[model samples]
Target: MRIILIGFMGVGKTVVGKSLAKNLSIKFIDMDNEIEKRENKIISDIFKESGEEYFRKLENDLLKELVKQDNIIISTGGGIITKQENIDILKQERKVVFLDANVWTIQKNVSKEINKRPLLKQSENIAETIDNLLKKRINKYNDTYNIKIDINDKNINEVVSEILVHIG
Candidate 1:
């Protein structure tokens, strides 16, 4: 069973995914980390050097390759659902869960560590960018996910339990 978690950055996909994978005894893979390893560059560096379009293409390709694996819990990049083809490919192979958290929750979690995210570099208008990006992709996220999980105010254990219930 391949379980894919998709959501905006700082929604705890990686943190929750790691816990869920350990509980389920499955391999955990973060797509962004995989891309960085493959390119031998950090994601921020890749976006800076090659442009977002190029980085997105790399992400799309990696997504395609990752769906072929078994018993894996994959945490996808926030913008992975921007492309319809990527959504289609993920749905074909695995059950996708959207980790639904409000924009404020996301902003609060990510604000201190904005530099880690290549997409949120500008300090002055970070909130605006996050809002715009979330707005633009929410429809795709809604359409693509098999299960929608609201993680606001929820602890990791609760989120993992919710996911396991949905999967069953």
Candidate 2:
């Protein structure tokens, strides 16, 4: 089985995806980490050097590659759905899960690691930025995921359990 987790940044997609993969005894792949590994640079550096358009193209290509494999859980970058190609790919998957979290939850979750995120670094006000981005992407997220899991105020295990129930 291939499980894909999608959401805005700081929504615990990576955390929940790892736990879900472990519970199901499958390999877990974080798309950002994979892209960094392949590019030989951190995502922020990729953004700085090559720009976001370059990074999104890489992301779309990687998503195409990853979807062909089996028994893996893919935790995608927050903005992966921004591309029409990516949304089309995600819509074809059976277990694409949208892990939804509110603006306050996202801000609190990502406060410590703001430097690691390229998009957040560009924001003058993180909360407002998050809100605006979420507003733009929420409809795409709704259209792409077959299942939606609310991650607000939930532990990783709780989220994983909820995902298991939905995917089982």
Candidate 3:
């Protein structure tokens, strides 16, 4: 089985994906991490130097490759839905799960790792920024996901278990 987790940043896609992969005894791939590994630079650095267009192209290319593999769980970056080609690719998948969370939940989750995020650095009010982004992306997420999981009140295990139940 191949499962792809998609949502806004700080929605716990990576954490939930890892647990799901572990329980299913499959490999877990964080798309951003994979891109960082391949480029030998962090995502923020990629955005800073090469720019977001470059990063998005790299992401698109990687998505094309990863979808061909089996027995893996892919946790995609938040902005993957921004590109039409990427959205098309995700729509083709059988198990694309959108892990949904509220603005306050997202702010709390991302605060610890704010330094790692490039987009958040562009904003002064994190909550308002997050809300705006969510508004823009929520429709795309709704259209792409086969399963929608509200992750606002769930732990990693709970999220994973819920995914397992749905995907099973």
- Prediction-by-prediction clash tally: 0, 0, 0
Per-residue lDDT tens digits of candidate 1, residues 1-168?
A: 999999999999999999999999999999999999999999999999999889889999888888888899999999898777898886675489999998888998898889988888865787788888889989989888888999999999999999999999
Q: Write the candidate numbers in order of decreasing TM-score.
A: 3, 2, 1
lDDT of 2 by residue, 128-147 (tens): 99999999999999999999
Q: Would you list the rank order by lDDT, best first? A: 3, 2, 1
**Weakest ten-residue segment in model 2 by summed lDDT:** 13-22
In angstroms, the error of model 2 at 114 is 0.6
lDDT of each: 0.90, 0.95, 0.95
Candidate 1 — what's its lDDT? 0.90
Q: What's the TM-score of every candidate structure?
A: 0.95, 0.98, 0.98
- For every candidate in turn, the CA RMSD to the true structure comes to 1.1, 0.7, 0.6
Kindly give the stretch of ten consecutive residues in candidate 1 with the minimal lDDT sum: 85-94
**RMSD in Å for model 1:** 1.1
Instruction: Look at candidate 1 and give me any clashing residue pairs.
Output: none
Off by over 4 Å in 2: none
Tens-place lDDT per residue, model 3, 12-80, is 988888889889999999999999999999999999999999999999999999999999999999999
Query: Which sections of candidate 3 miss by over 4 Å?
Result: none
**TM-score attained by model 1:** 0.95
- Candidate 1 Cα deviation (angstroms), residue 48: 0.5
